[model samples]
Target: MVVLKKKEMMQCYTFFLLIIVVVASAIPTKADDQKKRVKEKSLSDASHSEDGEHNNDYDHEAFLGKEERQTFDQLSPEESRDRLGKIFEKIDKNSDGFVSEDELKDWIQYVQKRYITTDTERMWKDYDISDTNEITWNAYMKRTYGYGDAGEPKEGDPVYEYRDMITRDKRRWERADGNNDDKLNKEEFSNFLHPEDAEHMREIVVLETLEDIDKDKDGFISVEEYIGDMLSDQKKGEPEPDWVVNERKQFTDYRDKNKDGKMDKHEVMDWIIPTDYDHSSAESKHLIYESDKDKDGRLTKQEILDKHDLFVGSQATDFGEALTRHDEF
Candidate 1:
């Protein structure tokens, strides 16, 4: 047995404490996992920032559809006008020679649908290990979670978060399987992956949001909870970024309408999935507002072509969906 004097023992203890700190620092924190979790925002949230700077890329992507985003960006002014002309014909579905709010809304929805369709096909390749038209829930579970049945790892285990995620995926999968055949077709899988974009899956999206931010499991999100979720990267005693501060204000002032110091299910629904606030509809109005030079309620082909820069990419074209599509516009 080794014996040490008091000072020597203290030095050994200090060395072990330093090693412990290094190991602890190497482990990823809960905040990191929280940040990686689903905080996916809607189109409206993506289009505008906290500082009110309109991100034209998001609007353009929404306007032109994800597939056409790069096509429009790299286009010359003349080329932009040419493509806009073709898209205009599509938007003016009734052959009315004018784009109404409803027509524009329909077009935007179509673009989003196209995005979902394309994205699902790309993602499906990885999950369809059986090389079939549909994916079974068991296959998904095995592929994603490395197990056919997620038998709850103890909470705080490294994989406990994955168990929670698997549970969420299963709930979403069931919702996606409208036919309840225990499998998902492409469309159903699209809805599963992008419940945020689907109308019928609104409740699941809201429920998931509540589950994520409602730390106390009180079925409501308090101000602290909202701020905490947004500031997942923030450490204790660290100062919040300006955007987080602005979001805190937005939550209190605009989000919590009843002023109960917290948000109930209804309030959360309004905040996340407001009945009146349709992303497609809002973008439609905004499109007309920006491009309708005639001051009329509808947009003419000439008007859209004139504002081709607004509708498509003028300056940069290598982001979002553009970079991935290797072929030219």
Candidate 2:
């Protein structure tokens, strides 16, 4: 029961979960192509429905990231539209009458950056107890894994996963330590937390990916291992779904380039780090695709104002605020 309770708490606070290894894998078995496909349709950077309905909350998040979305949610419909109109002008980037793709993409990136800043500050307070403007490796480990009477699980304990997670966090933390001092200042801590957002930390992201899906400990991914990762969620007695079967074919036909029958390091890199998928660009294109009237391929101020409800007009979309009011684990 205690283990189950910890698992539940971990899921809720999993945004900074690279350290919580057992609770979350740093990468997916594969980047969820289904969600990626759905993202292209709705303005969602995450997942959505097949029919591409106007997912208001998702669009809001894609345009303004998680934290900003919560802030926007506080606005009344009239106030929301007025504020969105001001934001749209800034997104236009030039004095041009329309918002070009580049302009929209840049704005989305800015919104995401703002969210990352807030997230880093919020989490920084938890680890930087000494207020020395740095989060030491020992400080982080002590705060996260904990100490004293069985606070941390031991080698043979039922929750032994923490041991492996501690090792993994140390590797990542070291990589983020650009100064080589074994301590992460504020900037380094952000890189440590969200490596995906940092260009330099791409290798760490890939290393974590390989460590995650390369489960055979043989240093490569076989087609069976690739398929098996997906089946982690499959029920005990159920037959493999058609999509699962199709994925097996995808591995041989598309994923396993060079006809090697197994994914080498480069192959795994190519598979996960797709070149074409840009979350900001995808959301921008989809937003323009749906809301752009007169088929102009770009949004005019009035066109966006007309579709204000589709963007920030979400009310019941409040996420986890009430839940967060409780004492976190």
lDDT of 2 by residue, 1-329 (tens): 00111111122222211221211223222222111110011122333321233345556666755544554445566766666667777788786878887888897777667656767787887678776788777667556545323234577754355455555667778889999987889899888776766667667666665666678888888988877665655678989765555567778887799888888777766664455556567778878887888887888888888987566554556521211212211
Q: Which TM-score value belongs to model 1?
A: 0.73
The regions of model 2 sitting more than 4 angstroms off are 1-45, 48-60, 68-83, 93-97, 148-161, 305-329
**Could you estimate the TM-score for every candidate?**
0.73, 0.70
lDDT of 1 at 72: 43
Q: For model 1, name the residue pairs that clash.
A: 73-313
Whole-model alpha-carbon lDDT for candidate 1: 0.63
For candidate 1, lDDT tens digit of each residue in 1-329? 01111211121111100000011223334433232222333342232432455556556666765555554445455655665677788789899899998999998877666666666777687676676688898777666555565455577655565566656667777888999998988788777777766677767767777887899998999988977765655679988665666667777887789998899877877775567656677778988998888798999999988876666757465323332243423
**What range of 10 consecutive residues in model 2 has the weakest lDDT sum?**
1-10
